[model samples]
Target: MKTLLLTKEEVDGLICMHEVIGAVEEAYKAFNSDQVVQPDYMGIHLPSPRGEVDFKLGYNKANEVISMKASSGGFIDNPTAHGVPNGMGTILLFDARSCALTCVMDGSLITGLRTGAAGAVSVKALARKNARTVSSMGTGNQARMQIRAINEIMTIEEVRAWDSHPDTLARYKTDIESEFGIPVVTANSKREAVEQADILVTTTRGKGSLVEADWVKAGTHIVAIGTDQQGKQELDPEIFRNAKVVVDSMAQCAEKGETWHPLNKKIIAKDDIHGEIGEILVGKKPGRENDHEVTIFDSTGMAIQDNVAASRIYQNAIDKGVGTFFEFFRS
Candidate 1:
């Protein structure tokens, strides 16, 4: 059998933000229809102050493909010590029918793109039609991708951003303004960013709540992206009290994502959740019924997202002859 090997650059070249958003939206629809088989993510945590590696795997029955991703992060000193980023990931895709390893690709870019696409999907389904201002609480790669994806789906007039590092915030501002021609503003505080936003995004690695409930407006839509692990929080638990909370996966979010804190502390119950984003995508449930309703999308990241995105990229690579193909075994 032959396996296609793709680098991060090659994968990036194969995918555009609009295509990713479409693919991720379909993946969510498939998931809601019970056309996907996904397991909970498993993680191996290193000692405190270090990092952790996580494994996420799933199959899209509709697409007849399976994928597995191994991702690691949380080592703050990686850049200084090893000259590498704080996080890294790789993806493996296989044919379900033949059980053949069809592709091996860098998953770091896929991770960011799909995550951004997930937020875009939520924004499209939940955010108000007049949501012209977007706010982000981090100025990193994920934040950039989130803005890019949102720009593809919605007409964002202004972006308000905040970061602990001033240089990072400035760079994010410059990049967004240059690439998308959208006005970018640097907020002096997180509260200022949240209060001014019609659509709020939290993509930080902080382990505590960065947004308070009172800071959010009634019509706001929040996409929480950073709380994919236990004890990592970005939104206040009280924020879920009167909000229409939609999660990527109920089981996954209940255990690891932003829903965990609220569910754990009895701030909210599972029944309080409106539905998974898939349900909204499939039209089994409604999204953002009224403009005055506060809505929150708790994104924990899903393997099916990776599988669907990788599958799309793999096919694009094949059609464009973008990646290297090598024989791994001979029959």
Candidate 2:
């Protein structure tokens, strides 16, 4: 039998931000509702080159497909030293019935969008209905993706941005204003941005706390996008202590995500977490009970997202007659 192969460009053309957001929400629902079986994820570290690749494997009973995603990051010299993106990935999709490899595709776009959508889903579930200001703490690629996904679900009157790199910050303002047609203002400092935000998103690759608990005001909903890896933190643990914290996965976050730091520091106990995003989406728990309540969503990313997204992309390719087919066993 032949296996389908899809390039990154093809995959980008096949799915939009809106569709990716919907698929990610479905994945979360399936995962929290006990329809997805996720195996333990594996990470391989490379010390000399300073890079890491993580493998997330799972079976989506809801979709009747098995999927594995491999994402590589931390190649700090890729852009200036090399011509390609620092992060690259590949996803393998297999048939649940026969366990046959069905398709192979570039996983970078899916990985980016799924994570971006995860933040959007959290905002949709927890942010106040009248929230109009967004403060983005970083001006990287993930920052752009998060803004795009969130714009699909909310009305943003203004976007306040802050970054350590002045050039990157300036470019972000130009690109976002041109693309979204919304006012993008550059903040002089992180506190200046965080203090004025109705919704805040942190997308920096930092190893220290970036946002202070006191900087965040009441009734704000924050999407903590950084701190997915061990030893990386963006917000003070005190922030977690004061807010209604929701994680993408309790087990994963407790060990590696933002939830882990707060636990290690004894600032907040495990019970302090209100619930997982899936739980909130499935109505097993409440979200944003009142406008005055402060909420934070710590997203470490998960496998169910990859499974559902890859499944959707594969099916769409088949329906649209896209991708290349080659015999995997060319005997």
Candidate 3:
């Protein structure tokens, strides 16, 4: 048996934000149509570095995309102690018809790209169609990817960014502004960046809340990508509890995402979460029914998303011979 190996750089070179957004939208549609099967993810904590690894596996039968993903690494103690990244992962795609290994993709790039695309999907589904401004928290790879994905979907004229590190935020502002052709501003505070923005995206790994409920407006749409961990949170859960909250998966949200702690504390009930994003995408439920409704998209990340996006990029890479080939078994 032979397998195609895609390095991180190769996989990064293959993905585009627009394509990823399309992939996410398609996955959600298939999920809503009952064409995809997914299992709840499991978490494993690494002892030495004090981080957690997650597993998400799914198959979209109609779309012919199958994948299992394991993402880990968060050595928060030191910035550059290891030569590797703070997070690392890979995607293994299997052919639905043949059950054969189709591709092996670098997970880090896939995670960032797919997560950003999910944010883009939420923005498309919930944000005002004519929105032109976006405020983003955190100045990392996900932040950059979010800017790229959002820019692909909307005609964003300006992006405001905030980070605890002043120098990093400055560089991020310069780089993203130049790349996306949007004026980027560095804000003095999270509230300053969040308020008055048509759309806001939170991507930090911080454990404390960054955006408050009062700072949000009537028509604002928030996409919170940070609070995927049990103790980590970036947005006030009151905002989520009060708004028409949509999650990637209700189960995952109740277990690990922003809704986890609050749910455990009984601040939010099972009925509090409106529905899955797939339901809204498939038109089984309405999204943003009124202009005055505040919407929050809680993205904990999903495996079906990785499989769908990775498979698409992998097929393109195969046709272009973008990655190296190796044999896994010899008969």
Candidate 4:
């Protein structure tokens, strides 16, 4: 069997913001329609200075995609040392009917694109249609991808960002403004960045809240994407309480996502959450009940998203005649 090997650069070349947003939207619809089979993610904390290892696997029957990914949390210690990313991963794509391996693609870009697209999906489902201003926290690759995804779903006129590192924030402002043809401004503080924005996306991995409740406006839609694991936080707990919260997966959000932080602190009760995004997508629940209502989409990053996105990329690569072929299985 010929296995397709796609590098991160190739994967990046193959995907665009519009395509990723559409793919993730399809995945959300499939998930809401009860067509995907996803299992609880399993994580293992390696006893090492290297850090924890995480593995997640899932299949989407409607989209005919399966994905398995693993990441080692060590590369961030010295990002420039190996000319590679801190979070490295690989996604295995399979034939849904035959359950045979079809391709192996770089997972780092897949992770960023899918998660960014997920944020876009949330924006589409929850944000006001006329939302034109965006505020982003963090200046990492994920933050860049998130801006790309946001632009795909909305006609964002301006972008504001703030980071601990001034150099990174300055670079982000210049690069994003040049790329997106939108005004990008660097803020002095997280509060300054988030305040007066129509949409806010928190993509930092800070262990404490960088977003405050008061900074967010009544009609702002907030997407918290950084806290996909326990102990990670980005938004103030009071923001969650004031806003009607929608989660990708409530069960997982309770354990590892942004909601976990507030829940543990007794800031917001479980029932206070409106519903899952899937439920809202399926029409089982409502989204953005009123423009004045502060809406939040707590994204923890789900396996179904990975499966659907990787599967789409694999098929696209095949159709476009991209990726290197090797005989992983031969007669």
**In each prediction, how many residue pairs overlap at the backbone (N, C-alpha, C within less than 3 A)?**
0, 0, 1, 1
lDDT (Cα atoms) of all candidates against the true structure: 0.94, 0.91, 0.85, 0.84
Q: Is candidate 1 or candidate 4 better by lDDT?
A: 1
Tell me each candidate's TM-score.
0.97, 0.97, 0.93, 0.93
Global local distance difference test of model 4: 0.84
Against the true structure, candidate 4 reaches a TM-score of: 0.93
Model 1 CA lDDT for position 137 = 97
Candidate 3 per-residue lDDT over residues 14-104, each given as its tens digit: 8688889999998888877878789988888778666888998999887676799989867565456766767789889887887778678
Model 2: worst 10 consecutive residues (lDDT sum): 43-52
- For model 2, which pairs clash? none
What TM-score, to 2 decimals, does candidate 1 have?
0.97
Model 4 lDDT per residue over 227-329, tens place = 8788788988889888889998888899999998789989889999998888877788888878898998999877887887787778789899999998767
Q: In angstroms, give how far residue 283 of model 2 lies from its true place.
A: 0.8
Model 3 clash pairs? 89-107
Which candidate wins on lDDT? 1
Measured with C-alpha atoms, the lDDT of residue 329 in candidate 3 is: 61
The runs of at least 3 residues in candidate 3 whose Cα sits more than 4 Å from the true structure, single-residue gaps closed, are 48-50, 76-82
* Local distance difference test, candidate 1: 0.94
